[model samples]
Target: MKKKIVALTAIAVLSVGTAAQAAASSVHTVQSGDTLWSISKDNNVSVEELQAWNELDSTLIYPSQDLKVEDKVETYVVVKGDSLYKIATKHNISVDDLMNWNNISSDLIFPGEEFVLQGTKASTTNKTAQKATAPVSAPASAPVQKAPSAPVAVKAPASSTAGKEMTVTATAYTAYCAGCSGTTATGIDLRANPNQKVIAVDPSVIPLGSRVWVEGYGEAIAGDTGGAIKGNIIDLFMENKQDALNWGRQTVTIKILD
Candidate 1:
């Protein structure tokens, strides 16, 4: 009876050890050219969740990073000329959110970097999807004409229920034309900077948290405004004097989309 008791105890210990091992070894395979964005899209997971799961500093990933969780992660093959930013936009998510999801600290992603996306594919990418698709007003034959010049003396939009003050959080990187003394930046240069956080918002018209779909630029939440950008005015950031001049002031209609 003593021997049988000892044997049973040993078996119990072994079973517990097996269970612990299983809990610790939820591994995921790496595929060719897999990026965190693609994997997140396929698996229906946010890039943020993936990052938390793996404790990544940036979006950088390598082949065959073993995931310890039993949750399902989707995978995608990387194509040549792919970028993390573009991939994030394509999936309708912010770059920062994607980075956080994958526990990544850098923007570098190579082919076959496996990542786990959380949730059903549809819900994860819906927020970043473009809301306004109205064709930009331009000349009949010219290649996208400039917006109409700002009214000489800008008139404020109709006043709503006594200007209520509300707090808004940063949903995405918003553009600003704060530097009025320099040339404006082109589209490519405008969207490249990561440090720029200045947002050009029209206060009375767009209340806080109201998502504003800019004409030339993509979607941006109405988060903040500059001293000079009060009322109907907007100040978009420019790289240099040349860019500002090139993208001269135009009448851009701010569509309040959600």
Candidate 2:
């Protein structure tokens, strides 16, 4: 009958639609002798990524298990007090990577905006391959001569006044100073992370743990406090005494990014 034919045609269309949806999501079945590292190698992904995508606490797997081999698009929603640097630091990723993943050319990002956390697998694999194939320098038998220090031109990051901006008198200090514990008041270990960008601020003026953009200094975290760092005065952190001395004192503009 015509009615029976119509019902069978509708059922066939629904079955085909379901099959297409399943095929779109790439899933790999775990077989005997399979490991996370081996599966990652076969799929052109990293073992860390495998664990993250599957939300697996460990590398243990059994036969006939299903694993998601496709790259999962992870995203983060910007909050009231969030900056690219802050979010990248929290996620243990670079700010450049974060910006590139989101196709962001500027540092300006608004609250409630969503940003992608990961790039495509091809990009990630290419970066890893480049690192692995990089040429290593041969060890020098003789003492290498030190080059003369040149005046390096530092490029400041793009300016943004998304939050409060203030002109503050800035001074530089090193963590290796005499009698210094190399720890900030906010519990950031400067000695352990000499490259970490941090600045001492008056908690009343710039709240601790705030992401601030300092003029000529780029982005930094307000993670320290000083006895003399009162009012509009801020102390920038440097890795070495020479760098601190070079920075000396300057009047700079600071924007509280978050």
Candidate 3:
């Protein structure tokens, strides 16, 4: 009976150890020549999963940077003054995922509400499969055009009313900038459409979603905003980082066209 009791105790201890090991978080340290794709492949996880877990805005990673690779279900209770974006940033997850996991269409959330942080593997797999099988085609309503190699000189729509004209200090920016998610404030995917004519401006000065004509950079949609872009400051979007570097900083005239 004593031997049997000792054996049972050992089994119980082993079970607890196994459970703890399964629940432990996994991390991967970036090495030279390491890419998110390679790391995700090696870890049997998707690249999106890695990005969500690490809260990476871009695919860029550096040597010795630690990344969370494990996907574990977590529940978060909303506190006072909590927003979806805030909660998502805090948990290193995407706002879209947060809404999808909780089946909420709107961003509105009340205090004490619970939200799932991680998506189920089966759902992710299904999405991947669906994407793989879907047909790829641009919408006929809005035809796709090849973007110009350089900013082209264009006039604003003749029908639209001209708004305020201001001479602002302008700087260039790219989608690959550090901590940049390649997404604009108005939901323009810069990384996917690098050649899209867009610029960041202070919405108070130049309203967002307005067409603006930059003195030298041609006409672009004022579709983005930045923390540093305040008052008389604007940021031009460039497809190439070298082009952005070449632009540097300059004072330019901009006319907002509605």
User: Model 1, residue 10: displacement in angstroms?
Assistant: 51
Candidate 1 per-residue C-alpha lDDT over 40-158 given as tens digits, one digit per residue, 9 for 90 to 100: 43343334555678897765666555532323323232222335565565667655555544544545554323332432321222122121322122122312212222122211211
Model 3 TM-score on a 0 to 1 scale: 0.39
Better of 1 and 3 by lDDT: 3
The per-candidate count of clashes, in order, stands at 40, 0, 0
What local distance difference test score does each model get?
A: 0.38, 0.59, 0.59
In model 3, residue pairs whose N, Cα or C atoms come closer than 3 Å (at least 3 residues apart or on different chains), thus clashing, are none
lDDT of residue 218 for candidate 3 = 75
Question: In terms of TM-score, which candidate is strongest?
Answer: 2
- lDDT for residue 58 in candidate 3, whole number 0-100: 70
Question: Candidate 2: what lDDT?
Answer: 0.59
How do the residues 142-255 of candidate 2 rate in per-residue lDDT, one tens digit apiece?
Answer: 122222322222222112322567899999988877666787765455887889888998878986556678888877877778778899999999998998999889998787
Off by over 4 Å in 2: 1-162
Deviating ranges (above 4 Å) for candidate 3 = 1-161
Minimum summed lDDT over a 10-residue window in model 2 is located at: 1-10
- Candidate 3: worst-modelled 10 consecutive residues by lDDT: 1-10
- Candidate 2, after superposition: displacement of residue 229 in Å? 0.3
